[model samples]
Target: MAENLNPSRNMCSTNLSLLLILLISSPRPAISRTRVQFLPGFDGPLPFQLETGYYLFSYYWANDNDVRKALNVRKGSIGEWLRCNKSIPYTTEVASSLEYHLNLTTKGYRALVYSGDHDMIVPFMGTQAWIRSLNFSIVDDWRPWLVEGQVTGYTRTYANNLTFATVKGAGHIAPEFKPMECFDMFYRWISYSPL
Candidate 1:
């Protein structure tokens, strides 16, 4: 006796079989976080490589639009950023207020003020001027911090528990430029150990 098969049913079975094969072969997301190797001087084992500053900048801008949208910022033209929003004007009063808060209000809090020695965008001299205006007594005098038996930068601690540090051979992005020193400084500060 000859059996009759439904063409539609056969097609459905074939589709279901293909779907199961795909589902079985696909890679799964990791269940647990993998430990990262702390290689201070080099970037990555990043999932992908960023070759230069231009690449980093491009990545930042490309991602920034999504971030802005998520934050509910008013959208503008495509690929355009709204630089100014007619917000309150900036003045020295703002700087003084921040300085006051840092000097007097944050008694128990630990504050970290850092600069890249090579940063011209916001010069260390200007930062120093403002910090000096705070008049916080120096707990630790300015001295060079050593890494790999060489001077990495200078640091000083203030009576209010604020610390100022400079990263040598660094520019606007100090942490990126000197990852090892930045990590060391961060760890030491967070651990309440000497930096």
Candidate 2:
């Protein structure tokens, strides 16, 4: 005797197979493209074509010359002025200071790790994750840190004398974006005041 199969089950399977085949063979929807004339960090309209599989590169002066002039370093000084070039060969390598941080914490050294909330270069989320990985107990939970009665940012403190903070409305360069807030935060931290 031939094995019996449920008719409804067979029909459902056939329908599902057809649906899958249709889905697989169907043409994908067109991808719409919009030309972005300007970007946030960039000054004016972009000069290069913005397209798929292409990256735009921008380089900013590191301001080492200004620092050298401010320090009044002699032209023929024996010690070379610090080079602020970002083109160091090993910069792309994966580097972590977690061990050093742990060492410092064990030695009872206090640390403040802050991030700009609006920073695109080194995002706050990544900074938070790095802090979390330290496995330090929270001494103080998240709270808004204020400056002159205005909430400047949020901060949290850990058991190992480590504090993490986010600067409100700041970008990659937090001090440049919010100098007063940064200064206040720094002053409070250095003075051993709660932020």
Candidate 3:
């Protein structure tokens, strides 16, 4: 008698073999449909505030009592009020603003968000938390940023042309604390460079 042959078993085995071969042959990373490029940091003309001697004087000048008087920002006045929310209990409506930032970035507009690592008021951690909620893919992984041969802080760039940076050892007012680093960060950001 001839050996019995099951047609369904043969077909299933053949299909499974073909599927395995296909997967094995294409054992490679899938090419992305959209490519993202990232610039690490700027290596161009330095911003005015970052220039030697200027940053110190400018930072001090901006925070001087004369300027405060001219701006009518007396002690315990609107300037202080604006920095803290203790005077009035309120909720921030920044979610919509964040969405708007993402929308603008998607439309080809660049954005930069920076914070002082040591800031207790409106801390950098909170800022980072909100930024991560935007869900933008990071093109440049976080790394230390350098200025004048010294590490200023860390920086990262996103696919949506958004950059986030931190000013090391700085407070809520990054410029006031780390003026040169802040200047470099802002300069790079405005010039569409990086960091």
Candidate 4:
């Protein structure tokens, strides 16, 4: 006895098979790569390396739309509004805020300067050196800071109401890498408790 198949089902199957064959046989568009030599508002060819192509496009798409609207900023790209130039290299000498820090310290403003121990971009040693340059006596010497009975990092207090801390095992962005430990550190500092 021959097996019976629904006519509609048979027609659907045939149509799907043909569609798949067409899709598989169709030509794909060629991907072309073009290097960006310069950007608008920048004086010459890009000074630093320019990496193109799509790796993570979502980050580029992210913007503080609400913040811009609240701040009464006209509708424009955030980078343009901020006059940000990605080609410019960030260096300590070029981007030092030490003078402002000194002024704040002299005015008796308490400050917290925290660094990630694993942050090579802005190492803790550099932070220590700058803090020492302020000539503030040590109020609290370097000691282990704890979070939930575990050593989270090290902390030191300066005479000029300044505090320095190292977030242990954290990278450039400590809060992002060690959220709980960073939160505890921030909470303690803001509450005027020892880290």
Q: What's the count of clashing pairs in each model shown?
A: 0, 0, 0, 0
Q: Which run of 10 residues does model 4 get worst, by summed lDDT?
A: 53-62
Candidate 3 wrongly placed segments (more than 4 Å): 1-96
lDDT of 3 by residue, 1-195 (tens): 002212333112223233334433644332222211211122343232221222222233334454455545666564422222367878896656876877899998888888899889889989989889989899999999889989899998888888889899888777766776898888887887766
Q: Indicate the worst ten consecutive residues by lDDT in candidate 1.
A: 1-10
List, residue by residue over 1-195, the lDDT tens digit for candidate 2: 011212333112123233334434646321222233444333466565333110111111112233334445555563432234454455445477889999999799999999999998899999999988989999999999999999889999998899999999987778756778999999999999988
lDDT of each: 0.62, 0.65, 0.62, 0.65
In candidate 1, stretches whose alpha carbon ends up further than 4 angstroms from where it belongs are 1-51, 54-100, 103-105
Each candidate: RMSD to true structure? 15.4, 23.9, 29.0, 17.7
Give the Å error, residue 114, model 3: 0.2
lDDT of 4 by residue, 16-127 (tens): 2333344346363212122334433235765543333111111221233443454456686345322234676876665777789899998999998999998888899988
Candidate 4, residue 43: how far the Cα is off, in Å: 47
Residue-wise C-alpha lDDT for candidate 1, range 47-164, written one tens digit per residue: 4322233322323333354445544566774444323335647665453466565655366777888899988887777778878887779989999987888898999888778899
For candidate 4, report its TM-score. 0.57
